[model samples]
Target: MAANYDYEEAPGSYDDVNRQDLGYDPNFVPDSVKSFVVHLYRHIREKNVYEIHQMYENSFQTLSDRLFKDTPWPSVDAVSHYVDNDQVFCLLYREM
Candidate 1:
């Protein structure tokens, strides 16, 4: 996780969903979640196995626990456009 993203690298606490507030808004997507999805998608697209593993094992759970612990994740229909396949992503997301 440290190699993938350091506290120094993110500019602000916005990307540290596990540790920062990021101004909680149940109706608004947090910046940290947006950034995590983009970075994870980019890593998956590049076929960077190591980074993907790190993000999957470290970042995904952290954000999920911190941000969506008491709520359901947004539907695949809501976020699948960010990825290539809705069906595949839904399975992968369910695992996450």
Candidate 2:
């Protein structure tokens, strides 16, 4: 089941990391997951470790079950933009 996300990306530059290094995958990332990731970023930025822990321990798993049950989670390439393609964030996300 393909995700029904319509990404409206504004023009941007991906100079921070090698987009190619993320590897190419054409799968669409669901908008909900992308939004969740961005929200997670805010927690990280604010050093809200407890909230982050609660969100990951509860919300993220629930979200994955709801969103990815029908299809595997997409490749890092499809979702990394939400983290601004930061490799550390990508690695952490992959670990989760």
Candidate 3:
């Protein structure tokens, strides 16, 4: 027989979600994410694969550390967008 899984709803509305709800430090600074994105863009423009790989690994590690345990990894594009335009991202979440 196959096993069935049940999904649970979040405790609050999506707009209520924040760093704390996501298991991140409430005071976590986004500077690292922003720096990674800036370097990633620079590396891409300069075609520096070695440095790019290093940056990617570092960024992934940071992402893993910031997110809740067991949370699925986000796509690179998603991360990039979040880093580049977090204000817009938060506004969208609030508006939604």
Candidate 4:
């Protein structure tokens, strides 16, 4: 979960789904997630990652701290087009 993200369950909560499809991998465990956050924060601070200005203006989302609590982890679909895929839909609500 990204610290900057608000964890309230709301209409835009699913926005991360779009980011995941765009290229963000959202399945990292807590350790990896923390490491990623630190790395990204550093990258942002150092302006090492390209197009920082563009990324700064874009909308992004991430999961909440409570996202994994008591939750059965779901697998990413083996073959799914994010634009149009039933598997994505299945994965989204399979555990719920």
Query: Which prediction has the highest TM-score against the true structure?
Result: 2
TM-score of each: 0.61, 0.65, 0.41, 0.24
The local lDDT score (0 to 100) that residue 66 gets in candidate 3 is 52
Candidate scoring better on TM-score of 2 and 3: 2
lDDT sort, best first: 2, 1, 3, 4
Error of 4 at 3 (Å): 23
Tell me how candidate 2 scores on lDDT: 0.61
Query: Model-by-model lDDT, in order?
Result: 0.60, 0.61, 0.45, 0.36
lDDT per residue for candidate 1 within 36-75, as digits (tens), equals: 6667777777889998888887877766766566665555
Per-residue lDDT of model 3, residues 1-96, tens digit only? 211111112233241255456553433434434445555566666788777666555544545455434544333444546445555434432332
Locate the minimum summed-lDDT window of 10 residues in model 3: 1-10
Query: TM-score of predicted model 4?
Result: 0.24
Candidate 4 lDDT for residue 4: 35
Q: Rank candidates by TM-score, best first.
A: 2, 1, 3, 4
Ten residues in a row with the worst lDDT in model 1? 6-15
TM-score of 2: 0.65
Model 2 per-residue lDDT tens digits across residues 1-96: 222222222212231122234543346555656766777777887888886786687667766565454445667787887788988777888787
- lDDT tens readout by residue for model 4, 1-96: 223332223433344444344443445333323333334344555766453332233211223333343333323342223213454334533432
Worst 10 residues of 2 by lDDT: 2-11
